[model samples]
Target: MSWKDEIEQLRKRQALAKGMGGPEKLKRQREAGRLNVRERLDLLLDSGSFREVGSITGRAEYDDAGNLIDFTPANCLFGRGKIEGRTIAVVADDFTVRGGAADAAIIEKQIQAEKMAGELRLPLIRLIEGTGGGGSVKSILDMGATYIPFNPGWDQVVANLERVPVVSLLLGPVAGLGAARAVSSHYSVMVKGSSQMFIAGPPVVAGIGEQVTKEELGGADLQLAAGAVDDAYASEADAMAAAKWFLSYLPNSIHDLPERRETTESPGRRDPALGDIVPRDKRYAYDMHQILRSVTDEGSLFEMGRNFGQSVITAFARLDGWPVAVLASNPKVYGGGWTAEAAQKITRFVDLAETFRLPVVHLVDVPGFVIGTRAERAGTLRHGARALSAIYQASVPWCTIVIRKAFGVAGAAMMDHTRFRYRYAWPSGDWGSLPLEGGVEAAFKAALAGADDPDAMKDDLNRQMKSFSSPFKTAERFWAEEIINPAETREKLTEFANLAAPLREPRTKAPRYRP
Candidate 1:
C-alpha cells in the first residue's frame, strides 16, 4: 500500500479527462463536420509542442477507496503551446461538455488562463466554441439553486489586447460570453457554415417570441459584414492554418517587435505588370488585391475583414521578409472612398499594427471619405477623423505610394509627414484638393461663364489642369519625394521596409496598444 496506488488513481482520472465529452460525443463532433477539442489543438500547434495546464481538473465521483468511479473534465482545453517556435497561451473550450456550461471551477480556470497570458506577456489564442462558462440548466437541477450567468476575467482579456496579440477562432455556435471572446481579439476567424456567434441562441431568444436559426442570426457572412470577424474558412483545419499563418508576422508581445523571417523572395523583385496595373484613367478600376500581392512576398498577403469595409483593404504581408501592415484603397467599391465602416476598420487595423510594431504601408488611390446622405448620417466624418488621428498618433514607420487618384482629406490621411519621407509616387499618380475633372468648373467658373461655349471652356480647363497635375510637377518642386517607375515600386518599397526594421525593435511606449 505505497504511493503506487495514488499514482494509478491519478492516471485513471487523467485518462478519463483526456477522453473529453466521451466517445459518443466525439463521434457526434466528427459527424457534425467539426474538429474535437484535442484535434483542434493538434492542428493549431506544432507537433508535440503543447503542454496542457489543467488536464486533470473537473467534476469527479470517487469511492471511499479513492478509486475513480465517474469523472467529468472541464469544458476547456488550455495551457502553453508553441506555434512556429513562438510560445503562446491557448484557451480552447470543449463544446461537448454539457455545451460548455458555467461550472464554477471551470469559469475560474478560464479566467486564470487569460490572466496567465497577460501576466506572461504572451500572445493569447482563443479557440472558442459554445457558451463560455454560460448558464447550465442541468447544473441548476443538480445543485437545486439557479444562478445568473456571467463571466469574469474580461478586464484581463482586454488587457491582453493591449499587451500582446490576441486571436480567436469560432468553430461552433457561440453565445453569451463566447460571443464576446470571439469578437474581442485583434484577429478572429470563423468556420464557414459551421460557426455562428450571437448574443443569445435561438432557444433563449424564442422566449421573446422570435425564432431564427443560428446561421441566420450570426453566420460567417453576416458576422464578417458586421466587421466583428476578420476572415472565414471552409473548415476547422483551414481556420487552424489561418491562425498559424497570421501569428507568423506578429511577436509574442508588444514589449518586442515581430521577428524577421528568412526569405527566398528577393528585395529587388519587381512585378513587370505593376506598371500596367493602375489605369491612367481614374474612371477605370483594377484589382487592388492583385497589386497588393505583387508588391508583397509571394503568397504572403493575408487579408483581413474582406466582406466588411470593402473600399479599404487592411492586410498583413511580408515585404522581403519584413512584416508590414498594408492599408490600400479599393477603387472597385465606392471608388475607394472611406465609408463609416471603412474608417472604423482602418483605425482599428492601424492600432493593431502599432500595438505589434508593424510598419505601415499605404497604397493610396483614395477618392476621399464617403459622400451623400447615408454617409453623413452614418457619421463618416467622425470615424474618418478618428482614423486620421490614429495615423497621426502612430509612431510606426510609414510609406505611402500614390498609385492613382488621391484627393481631399482622405488622400491626405495616407501619411502625416512630408519632409525626409520614405514616400513614392508612380507614373499613374494623380492628385489634387479634389479631382481636376470636377474641380475645373469650380476653379474657373467666372472664365467659363464668360466663354461662348461653357462646355468647351470646361474641356480647355481640364486639359490645362491635367498638365499641372502631373506627379512630375510635384517632384520638380521637391514636394513629392520620389517618382519611380511603376515596375520599380516594389523594389523601392523593399528598401524602405529594410530601413524601417531597426527603428521598430526598441519599443518604450507606455500604452503600446490603443484599443
Candidate 2:
C-alpha cells in the first residue's frame, strides 16, 4: 500500500478510537438527566472559547499477539476556558472511560492543570462525578504490590482553595474522593435527584452495616444541611448556571480586585430607611439586611454563610463599584447573639476577606456572645475568643459602624483598631458591658423587694434604665466618633472605602487552609 494510503487509514483508526463509547453512551447520559463531561464544559465556559489540552489520550491496551491498541481520547477533558470573559482552568471527568477513574496519564493531566492554575493565578472549577480520579480494582495488577501514593492533586486542590475561589459541581453519583473535592471547595453545588455523594457506595457499606441507598447516605439535601455543599439545584444546567453566577462576584484571582457592574445609583446615595432602621427602643429587633441593602448599591449584596450562621451575616457588597466585605449581626436570630458555631463562621469569613485584602465594613448590633450552660458546653468561649483574635489580627482596612447594641467584649472586638482605620457610629449606637435588663434584675433586686408595689417597682426600674440606654446618650459622651443621620451611612461608608483603597496590602501565596 502507498504511504499516503497508510497514513489515511491510520487517521481513520484514530478517529474511530476517539469515539470510544460513541453515540449510545451519549444518549444514555442524556436519558439519565445528566450532562456528559463535554456538554458540561460547554455549558460552564464561553462558547467557542475552550482550548482542549489532552483530547487524544486514553487507556493503553494490546491485541492477542501483544500488539498495541489504537490510541483513544482520555476519558477526562481538561483545558483553558473563559467564564465571564476571564480565563480559568477547566477539568471535567468523563464517565465514559471506566467512570473517569485515575489512570497514569489522566492523573498527570489533572496535576498539570492544577499546577497551571496555581502558577497562572487563574480560578479552577472541577466538574466531578463518579469516583473523581481515584483508583479502580483493576489497578492492583497494573502496579504490582507497590501502591500509588495518594494523588498530590488533593493537596493542590486544597492549596487552590486558599489562594483563589475554587468551585465544584456534582452532576452524578459522586463517590469516594469526588465527594471530598465537592466539600473542600469554596463553593459547591449538586443537582437534586440526579446527584448524590457518599464516602462509599451502598454495596460496600452494606457489607459492614445496614443497607442504604446513595441518596439516603449523601443526597443533595443531606450535604446542604450538613454544610458540606453550599447549594442544591434541580438540574445540571442549573448547577452550572449557579456556578457562573457565583464566580461573577469574585475576582479572577486573589491578587486582583473583584470586578464590578455599572449602576445608575451613586455610592454616596443613601437609602432614607437607614435613618430610622435602628429602633430607639433598645429591646426592639429590626432586620439588619434591610439596612445593608439600602446602603449598598441596589442588588449588590452577595451573602455568604447565610444558612450556617444566622446571627452574623457576611456578604460581599458593592459601593461605588468597589467591593467590600460587610459583616453585620442579625438580631432576629439568636437575638443577634454570637454562638460557638456563629463565631467559627465569622472567624473563617474574616480570614478569607483578609486574605483577599478586601476592605471590611462591620455593622455592629451584637448584644454579646450567647451565654448559659449550653453555650459553655459548646465551647462558645474558645470559638468567640478565636473570632475576636481573627478580627483583631486582620491587617486589612476595616471600618466599623455601630448601628445599635454593641455590648461586652464581643462588642468591643467589632471596633476597628487605631492602626486599622475608621470607626463610626450611627445616632442609634448604644454600647456598654451588658444590656441593663439583666443588670437591672441583678442589681435592683433589693430595691424592688422593699417597694410596696413589687411589679410596678420592677416596671419603674426597667423604665428608668431604658431611658438612659440611648445611643444618643452615649454619643454625648464622645463614646463614638460621631452620631450621624441614617441617610449619611452610604456617604460615610464610601468615604471610608476611598480612604481604604490605597491601604490594601499584597499577600504572598500560601497553602490551602483546612478550615
Let me know the TM-score candidate 1 reaches against the reference structure: 0.94
Q: Write the per-residue lDDT of candidate 1 for residues 1-515, one digit (tens) a residue.
A: 58997888788888999899998988898898888989899988889999998889999888999666898898987999888788999998898887766653477778888998988988889999888754667767878887664458887877888887888999999988888888888889999999999998888888999899999989999999999899999988888888888888898888878888789978897788988887766788999998888888888898988899899999999998999999999999999999999999999999888888899999999989889999999999999999999898888899999888788999889887742477889888888788876687788889888999999878877788878988899999988878888888789889989999988864555354533
**Runs with alpha carbons beyond 4 Å of true place in candidate 1:** 63-67, 137-150, 418-420, 444-451, 510-515
Scored by lDDT, the top model is: 1
Output the worst ten-in-a-row residue range by lDDT, candidate 2.
505-514
Could you give me the TM-score of model 2 versus the true structure? 0.88
What tens-digit string does per-residue lDDT give for candidate 2 at 227-314? 6677788988888887876777667667776665777888678677777677767677998999898888788787765767678888
